[model samples]
Target: MKQPWIHNAKTDWWFILSPPFLVLLIIFVFQKQIQGLENHYSFYTWLFLIVFVDVAHVYSTLFKTYFVKAEVQRRKLLYLGMPVISWCLGIALFQFGALTFWSVLALIAVFHFIRQQYGFMRIYARFEPDNWSKKIDEVAIYTATVFPMLYWFKTPRAFTWFVNNEFDWLKNLPDYIGVITVLYILIVTVWIIKTIVEIIKTKTVNIPKTALITGTYLSWYFGIIYY
Candidate 1:
């Protein structure tokens, strides 16, 4: 029988991935206070945030794509054309405006991050048959990942996705965002309570799923707040 907290060797979630990510989160949170880092901090952030995680996550697909000959053959057109199409789209967006380019890219990155959590949840729940559990997992992860983004849009922070006042357009939208933010917090609280109750009833846990949710919550919350 599969244990609730861990999988066998073939399915272990590689707990090793969490520590370095948490370290990165800590570094990101305190970046501005580091005196000598004023000029070079962006470089390190780009290295860790962009190169290490962002770019590495993209290439991580190699395991499911190019490495599997049959899968490659199945998605041959997608594999062959996505790069070229993405390149063209990128140039077009940049030409439209650098702000347009970066904003769209940042939005896409958020979508990727959200989907990655869903994917991990699916993997961790592969043996689970309870749809309610899956649904709650989705809601919790989405709340954790997306609330920070809502916070960012409503309250500007030290970091920005684009330059040259490109996002100034958003400032004039409305004032009811405060209400929405409160509702968001309430919903997140409810989800947490629901999850805890379910865990008590089941008397078991999915360790990897729990880790992903916690990491997403911590990272997104701190990343945006500190940004």
Candidate 2:
């Protein structure tokens, strides 16, 4: 017998995605107010971004590392040395210039975001028996996540990864954005249809993978459009 794609129940998967979704939703609802609140309610924004989303999630990796003795022992050098190396590299970059620091950091952050989405797709694909199905899952999630960043690149937006003027290098490239957005939508549509076909045949759906893709689409689209 084969295991289901989602390791947990549908409700559990939803629960996992809800907090970030709600945070994004709150940010979307308060997009305009956030700019004004920068002075008055700056701490709140800091708490939401730095505390809740950023630092909190970084520490969440402890579940895969510190909490797991075997993993910690296996990757001891990585667990121990990465922070020091990252700090030194950060200092070196900042010494170069603020632009260098932020530009590098922003690129790394975007790459991290893309890789994280891809990682989640892999997790959700653990039970997938077919190589083609796994590849489709990979492509769908990556397309959904990456194209929005490309939109941000070619088209200016109010929100940014770090600071203002950091990602303002590209201007008025609507044609590039138009093409990427269409390609993204077409890829997503085909993936959805394929998933539907699989569900109809197998009488089951991969709840976690679907939720991850859906949340990626919602968050990325709204994050770009709203902000």
Candidate 3:
């Protein structure tokens, strides 16, 4: 039995992920026009704009429940602020001409950190043991950090495979039993398996729901890889 508020929240969030309309409009109508110009704007500037727009879309999801009450309003504002601040930092990194891929990776790491931290806080507020939350936090932090670094440095081909499906870098790997790409795939496979097992053991459907949402947003990337 879903709460009415929860139902409304999900409905409102659908607007954020409505790719066929809003996302396509942004990509085609706005970005394509901008790309044709011979302006001084670097690729990083356009990437920053894209990321800011994404943050804005996510922020819009809070409006579904924002006006309900004072407490809810405050929490919604704070929740929205986290991603905004992170995106602002990412924009700063872009201005400094940091590697676009690494900057994006760092932004994702921060986003996941905030989400996992919020989950830990909520669980602790329910009187869960501090040790339990600590363990979860450590695992989440390590996984987030290691995965991004692996993709950025050692297994750039796997990272491309994760995103664009082009594996030109794979041909350059040493023909060894323990190549970095192979190791990265093994690590990610194990992580996914462990995550699914934990979700089942805890009987927590929210974990799977989060995964599904992530998969939905990355569907294009998966399509490129799998197809």
Best by TM-score: 2
Least accurate stretch of 10 residues (summed lDDT) in model 2?
A: 1-10
What would the per-residue lDDT of candidate 3 be over residues 1-227, giving only the tens digit for each residue? 22112234555346432442354455545665654541556556545755576456666766665655765766876767877998888777668544554546645754664464345334423433456533543344344334443344333332231235233344466654246446545645555565577667877534323433333324332322222
- Please give the lDDT score for candidate 2: 0.78
Task: Please give the range of 10 consecutive residues that has the lowest summed lDDT in model 1.
Answer: 8-17
Task: Give the alpha-carbon lDDT of every model.
Answer: 0.71, 0.78, 0.46
Alpha carbon RMSD to native, model 3: 10.6
Query: Tens-digit lDDT track for model 1 on 1-227?
Result: 36444445434544523753656566776765653564558779668867897689678989989899999899999988898999999998899877778778877866887787777666766787868767777778787767777667667656555454545555677865677668767867876787788779987666666776777777777667643
Best by lDDT: 2
Better candidate by TM-score, 1 or 2 = 2
Q: Report each candidate's C-alpha RMSD, comma-separated, in the order given.
A: 3.9, 3.8, 10.6
**Clash totals for all candidate models:** 0, 0, 0
Return the candidate ranking by lDDT, descending: 2, 1, 3
Residues 1-227, candidate 2, lDDT per residue (tens digit)? 24344445655456655655786878867867766887678778788968897789788988988899999899989988998899999999899889879978898989998998888777777767778877788888888788888877876565566887776655544468667868988998989898899899989877767777888888888777545
All candidates' TM-scores?
0.74, 0.77, 0.33
Off by over 4 Å in 3: 1-150, 153-183, 212-227
Q: Which residue pairs come into collision in candidate 2? A: none
